[model samples]
Target: MTQGHHLRGIMLASVACMLWGISGVAASSLFAMNPDVSPLWLTQVRMIIAGIILLIMAQGVGAQPLQLWQNKYTATRIVSYALLGMVPVQLCYFEAVKYGNAPVATIIQFLGPFIISLYYLVFKRTKPTRSEAIGMVVAFVGTLLIVTHGHLNSLAISPAVLIWGLLSAVGVATNTLIPRPLLTKFGSLSVTGWGLLVAGVCLNVVKPLWQVHLTLDWAQISMLGIIIIFGTVIPFQMFAHSLGYILPTEASLLDAFEPLAATVFSVLFLSVQLTGFDLFGGALIIFAVMILSLDAQTLAVLLHRRHSRNTD
Candidate 1:
């Protein structure tokens, strides 16, 4: 990529991160209005609305052709991505936030990268490089610190919430890892939009329109719309566009900012109190992500040394 293109890509990616960071605040405001609304229902509505909007926009901009789904293989991949990745990730995450605080849930969900590394190690039999290993350890330790609130002895997290949070992480990892090859064939907007549409369809199966009541006041409806536009649609488009110039791993490292930004927003706007431990733990997690984003050559050297030691 040219320097100008690189700068534009970075700007786009940063915009995505900023919008995603503010999503929690938007969701929080909505929840405050209608505490009774189930997270499942909310996520379903948001995805459907965002998907429709994107579909329209895609057509308008000619970013996606009329026969976007003409290929059978592409259709299959889109369906799979939506059902397994988008749906589960969004549902599990909202559920996690319902059960636990948003900041905590956001931090937990950010564990997707580490989970992706672990998944590759276990299923693909791929050994993690030394830098990856260090990153994993640091991130895990940081998570523990955050979850336990720096008081390991007083760890009293709800089991159900923890399970949901971890499952959300898994869903995110699957979304990121499974679509790599397909992404080469299809543009990001096409993949994301179709996947979102599929996920919306799947969600509707559980809670039909007859069961859902759109009784929200103007404020709530406006918040939901903003969430759909800014939180879901805009960020995805910006992130996808940025991917043309930046590598995926680098983009993911930049995404680590979302959780940190969410934490800050939660504390500032929502008046969520963060103990000293929370600050410390959050710092560690950010540090770990930075280490992981280091150049691959450094990681390769470290991995080589570890392999040599193992042979010895």
Candidate 2:
């Protein structure tokens, strides 16, 4: 990629991360306005709005939507992707947020990359490097710190919420793994759009049109629009585009910024106070992601090659 493209990709990906990071705060705000609004209903509305907007954008750009049924294999994969990956990830995430605190839910969900690494080690027989191992350890320490509130003896976690949070991690891992082949064949935009549409349609079963309250003040409507556009549509597309210019590992590492951004937003907007323990835990998480971002072997090899060439 050209330098200009690389810079643009980085900017877009950063924007996506920023938008995604604030989603929890947005959801929290909406819920604060009316606690009566169920998570299910909110999710349904978000998905439908996001899906429609993406569809319109796709049509405007002349990108063809996936006609999965025309090919049996593609159709089956699309169905599986929607049912297992998209729907479960969203539902489990919302459920996790409902059952547990947002910080806990997000930290657990972020464990998806660790789980993916584990899967690669076990199934693909790819051994992790020292850096990766260190990253895992650091990430685990961060989780422990977060869960225990830095007090080892005061680790009082709700079993149901913990289970749901872990389930969300699994959903994320599954989604990341399953989409590779489909993405290679159908392109990320098409696959993502279809997945959103399918998941949105499924959600509508619980929230009929008449049941959805369309009337909203300007602030509420603006929040909804932001969630639909920046939170959902723009982020996914930018992420996909970034992959063209940056390595997957680099892109993944950039996403680690989401938690830090979320925490800052939570502190400023939600008045969520962070203790020393929280700071320590956040440091550990950042360290872990930084470790994972480095390719130790590649760097070592390149340095050695350079030295040899210089000597020669």
Candidate 3:
């Protein structure tokens, strides 16, 4: 890819993360306003609407839309991705924020990148470079600081909330890894479109969306529209498109913006607190992501240049 394209990919990924952060804040607000709305119901509306729109977009761009359900193996994989990755991601993260607050829930789900790194290290049998290792450590420490607020004895949230948050991280990793080959094959729009569609259908089976009634006012309807359009569809499409131009590692690193943005939005709109520890911890995580964005070769070259300058 050209330098400009690469830069554009990074920008796209960053904006996608920011939108996701905003979405979390919006979803949290919805939950607070409509305590009767079930997670499944909310997810169903968002997924089905966005999925339909994306499926149309996929076909408009000359992708094989039918292939998402034609070949049995491909269909199965798509279903698995929907059920295992997308469903868990949306449901768990939303439930996390519903149970706990948005900031803590978002910070906990930031473990997704580390989980991806460790998955490669253990399962793929790839040794992490020094930079990768150090970045992971720094990011992990930052998460701890954010979660525990420097006190080990007291966890800020309940165990169930923590479990849901970690589950969201798993969903994040699966969402990244499973769709990669699919993105290369069926295209991002097709895979995500089908995944959302299939997942929405499956979830509706469990909890019929018709049964969940919400007395939504105009403001609530507007918020739900933002959640569906700006939050679900656009950002997901942009993030998937960025993967075509950028590596998964870089894309994942860029996702550090999500939690930071979520924290800010939550504080501003949701009455969430941003304590000193949260700031310090969030900074460390962002710094760690920056480090991870630099490849081993680049870091090595920079070190070599620094050493030569020092010798002179």
RMSD of each: 5.5, 7.0, 7.6
Clash count per candidate: 0, 0, 0
Off by over 4 Å in 1: 63-68, 153-156, 295-312
lDDT of 3 by residue, 1-312 (tens): 899899989999999999989988988898888888767788999989999999999899999788867777677778889999998888898889889878777877876756666776787566777877898889888878877889999985677778888899889878866665566668878999999998999998898888876799887888789889999889988887887788766886788889888988998888887788878887887787667667635433443454455335
> Against the hidden reference, what TM-scores do the models get?
0.88, 0.84, 0.86
Per-residue lDDT of 1-312 in model 2, one digit per residue for the tens? 699888887877777877777776666666666666566776777776777777667667766664545777677777677777877666677676665555556666777766767876787567777887999999899878876876788664566656776777777877776655567656776777777777777877767755776556777777667767777888989888887887666777788666666777777887766667667776787778668767534433433454455335
TM-score of 3: 0.86
Q: Estimate candidate 1's alpha-carbon lDDT, on a 0 to 1 scale.
A: 0.74
- Best-to-worst ranking by TM-score: 1, 3, 2
Best by lDDT: 3
Alpha-carbon lDDT, every model = 0.74, 0.70, 0.81
To one decimal, what is the Cα RMSD in angstroms of model 1 from the true structure? 5.5
What are the clashing pairs of model 2? none
Model 3 backbone overlap count: 0
Runs of candidate 3 with Cα error greater than 4 angstroms are 1-7, 243-250, 296-312
Q: Measured by TM-score, how close is model 1 to the native structure? A: 0.88
